[model samples]
Target: MTTSTHEKRPNILLITVDQMRYDCLSLLGHPVIETPNLDELARTGVRFDHAYSATPTCVPARAAIFTGQKQTSHGRVGYQDRVPWNYDKTLPGELAKSGYHTQCVGKMHVYPARSLLGFHNVILHDGYLHHNRNKHSVPMQEHFNEVDDYLPWLRAQVPGADLLDLGLDCNASTVARPWALPEHLHPTNWTVSQSIDFLRRRDPSKPFFLWMSFVRPHSPLDPPQAYFDLYKDADFPDPVIGDWAMKEDPQGSGLNPVTSKGLVPKRRLRNAMAAYYALITHIDHQIGRFLQVLEEYGERNNTIIMFTSDHGELMGDHHLFRKTLPYEGSTHIPFIVNDPGDCLGLDKGNVVSEIIELRDIMPSLLEAASTEIPDTVEGNSIWDLARTNGKALERPWREYLHGEHAQGMDSTQWITDGWEKYIWYSQTGEEQFFNLAEDPGELHNLMDSPQAQERIHYWRSVLIQELEGREEGYVQDGRLVVGRKPVNILAHLRSNE
Candidate 1:
């Protein structure tokens, strides 16, 4: 171990990938999709098999990651349309105050891409995609433009490339063409390049906290020609419920509701899956490059590297395309933490099966970095589990993991207690309960089962208690709002003007 003049504090490198499922990595033993770098990281670090996103969307899940609180507590529930700007303290802000140099690259999904929140330096690469907007000045929009720009180049590289027409909106007539290019030209590669540059130039005296968030394997399923070609002959597996062909969950379906469509055709599904997997592999390559730089800078051993996703992609799983559902395919994500033993004494290469939420990341980082965790933060640190090689010091440390999704009238609440998961929908008084241990695929609904009646009742009671505790009162016209804070002065001014 390298000795330091002062007590050595671990540097923090938190990597959040967009729309990544838990089983993508080779380490997770997936038959398809090669993620060698992530697999290696898992071997050197601790992987949490049961880790899940508190809010299975972009903004709220990100907010939960930055602040050790649930989405309801922080109030950032959905995309750009209805995200709450005013929220509680953030982890980066806390770390900055504690003498850590903070930086963020790639996507944060905050309203304004450059909203620092707490980082000293930020390179905003992607943000929310505004459906109604025309201008493409924002990072996310610009990134989409970049994809458009690269299409011509991709088409020229391939002999009969007609895949460029398969753009954003779902079109049954469209088909993807094979790509032939290097992974380094991908947007994720560029994001990793920016992060590596920042890491190389960052001052070593103060511990650094960098957020490398990559927007890949998300949508538009666009990978370079070479990556697409790599999976040309591979047999793409059908969705778990392919035989059923039943679209039970309306919101989770791959088809766009406004357009009134169904699942993409079999050929299109194969091409999309291939492109998606290629994007993931490309992302893994970028991650490997970033990790190499960290090692070269002698920061690997003294750094706490966390690899996770804001949420997961359905990726045609259960015939679902995007997130914002209460399913294993939508909510479950890979959470790997490489806490080098020199500083944190964390057991290397252990896979923890504890049911932890993304909100716990902030507190866990604080604990690992020897910094103070805020009292207002709702998540508890899993430092003990890490240090003790996945062994729980206390039984039943957490009874259940909670999640909320409130976008317009499409609101949902779910609680998972390892063995079972319960979901309650607000729009329609629909409830779904599943015994995950027995039925991993969640094909059977246990809410009406006589044997599961008591279990469902107990979980429903817990959900009610949690939601009641988080109820926010609103005012009509000029009446006083009981639980709502007054709108910020700047926001009020902007609105009035």
Candidate 2:
């Protein structure tokens, strides 16, 4: 470990994007989407190959990120809005306590619309939240037009223009279209622009923690014209449809625009894919712009940069379109930490295959900043693991991670250790197992295979042990109990002040 000296603390730059998959970058062997900027950033630091979001949705996953706690500790297991965000310890809060100037540029996804949680200032824009848009529960001043800082900025840029002018549904619907407004007017661009403004106005004396978040590549499938044209007619691969998915959705008939498990036709799916990729590329270029500004400030080498996503988008994998599932396409995400200052002695260009989750981000950042990690933060700092590539660790790392989320198909409980995965449905008691090392696409289910029975039983026991003392009584007499009602927010979180 580096000796603690009276050295200047490293500035932290957290760049987060919504609904970006782990395998979408060309550096990760993606055949179509090109993320040259992200690829270069990976080459400069450690890229986690098995990173995940346990509760693979916006709110719950972000809760893990901010609180540095697992789903059980944070109490958000699914996507639910309008719930109070009263966590005592937060990532930015800890950093700010260390004399860091903390500011968040994009999505916080917290309740009360303007809740800052910990950051000193939040130039907020939580893209298209149904709760804030509601006319009844939310007061008029708390509505999107009043609370969202980006709306007024956009209106000023183009008089009387609105984000919904294209008639695209923000969360659901797979419709694709080129952005009607100028490229710089898009939400993705606005996030970066606001971040640049923060850097310019920030107190240079204190180390700043800036969270530059982008809401795109999530939905609305609206890419700027130039980006859209780059992939509109390009060759794209077909979505990975598993045998199990075909059995449940045969003939491509489950065709609701917002259906979680439905078949999107070839042409329509391709259009959506192109638009998604375009948004990714757009964000990548904007990231490049921010890096250039950082260099111009002469702090590129003195800053610690981390790029990741809240969760992965299924992109039609296994007939799944969105997140909150226990599948790789939904839970897996890209995580890269580039400490140009080498503050943590991380092995640059190393691709760590060890299992990790969003909860780990908080402790890791606090550790790098030489700040004390609160007792409430349950996640272990990944500094040592990333430094030694798992050969040595200050503490023994977990063998597997437990993940779950409430869903329309009851709820999904899963366990994984990078190589294999086991999934159990809370209501149906149905089980599925996959050797992720062999079948990365999860094309086959091996739960019933004679040879895999022993392993499946072991994994099932792990789940049972995890849920033993839950308020829902998910386990009875050491056995998993099915038909239990799934809840969005766990009882512990609901009880929090």
Candidate 3:
């Protein structure tokens, strides 16, 4: 461990993307999507092929990330607000207490918008939240104002720039087009600019923790023309559809978030995906810019850089557009940890395939700073796995990750061990199992296969144990429960948000 002296303390840079998928990076063998910077970032450290966002949405996923605890403990079992984030030991809060100056540069999906959750300063940019701007939305309380930091800056930089010039609905629609404004005025760029500025203004006397959250590859599919052009004619892979997923096939209409969901035309799907890939590439370039800044400060070798996302986007997979599902495309997120080689005395280029979650971020970062991990935290530090390349550490490392999302959108629960996955739809009492190793697209349901019945029962029992005491009635009489009320933010906000 480093001494308490200021010079010995290293900086921690935690970067999170909004809705990027785990397989988007080129290093991960994505066919056409180019994420060169992120690929380079991965080469510098360890990347988890199986990292997941337990809640797989903006609000609840971030709750687990900042708290290092399960969604149940955080009281954000689904997409919820106004439940009151009463946790005492948060990621940044703990880092702050450890004498490290903490700053969040973008996207705190927390209630009240400016709750800080415990950052010293936050340059907020919660990209186009339906609840925040829609006056007709169920308003539970006064919030931190609907005006985000990026809009004001964009307007100031380009006098005639309009946020909605392309006629895209930031909340619902999945329209794809080149950005009307210059690339420099984009929110992704703005986030990095503000993060770089924080590095310049931070106190040099203490180790600093900066959370750079990018909101892109999510919606408002507007990339710069160059980026859009790069993928406009690219041979992108078709959406992988499972035989059992024919119910959600792209034969429906109206592209929106929750209500008018299920499949769009093939042309529209390709357009949305092309724009999405462009956004990922653009964000990767901006991250490259931020890393350049770190190198300039000669702090690159003294800082631990971690990259991840709140959750993955479905991107037309299983005919789904947004988050809140048990599918791999929705819950899987890319995670990379690049510790300065000499600084942390850690190995490099290790790829860990164990199942991990958003909750692991806090305890891992806390461990990096020599801060004690709180008993309230449930996530295992990735450091243990990184040190041994997934062979070391103690007992009770989760064999599988339990994932769920609370929204009327497929109120689902799933358990995956990175090889096989089992899902339970609470409302329909439906069960789906997939041998992920053989069917990464989740094309074939193996639940009814006589050969996989034993594995199905094993995972079902695991999920039952996971939800035993939950009020959602997910479990009862020592058996799996069904037909419970699905998780929904709209429903929760109608009462308290």
Cα lDDT, all candidates: 0.70, 0.88, 0.81
For model 1, residues 1-497, the per-residue Cα lDDT tens digits are 22362237778889998888887888866777899988888898888888899778777788788788876566655444323345447889888887788998888766544468888987765522553133544445334334232334445665454332434432221234433345554567768888888987886678889999887777656677777777766876666653333565455333442121246566767887787788788788888888888889877777888899888876666565567777787788998888664566667877777788988999998887777888878887876777674455865468788876654444567899667899876655678898989977777888668999999888877776666633332223332223243221223223433
Over the stretch 350-410, how does candidate 2's per-residue lDDT look in tens digits?
9888899999999988987889999999887887777888887766788999999988565
* Model 3 spans > 4 angstroms off: 1-4, 136-147, 159-162, 247-251, 254-261, 487-497
Ranking by lDDT: 2, 3, 1
Which 10-residue window of candidate 2 scores lowest in summed lDDT? 1-10
Best by lDDT: 2
How displaced is residue 428 in candidate 2, in Å? 1.2
Q: Highest TM-score among the candidates is held by which one?
A: 2
List CA RMSD, all candidates: 6.3, 2.4, 2.9
Pull out the clashing pairs in model 3.
81-497, 82-497, 242-443, 406-487, 407-487
Q: Evaluate model 2: give its lDDT.
A: 0.88
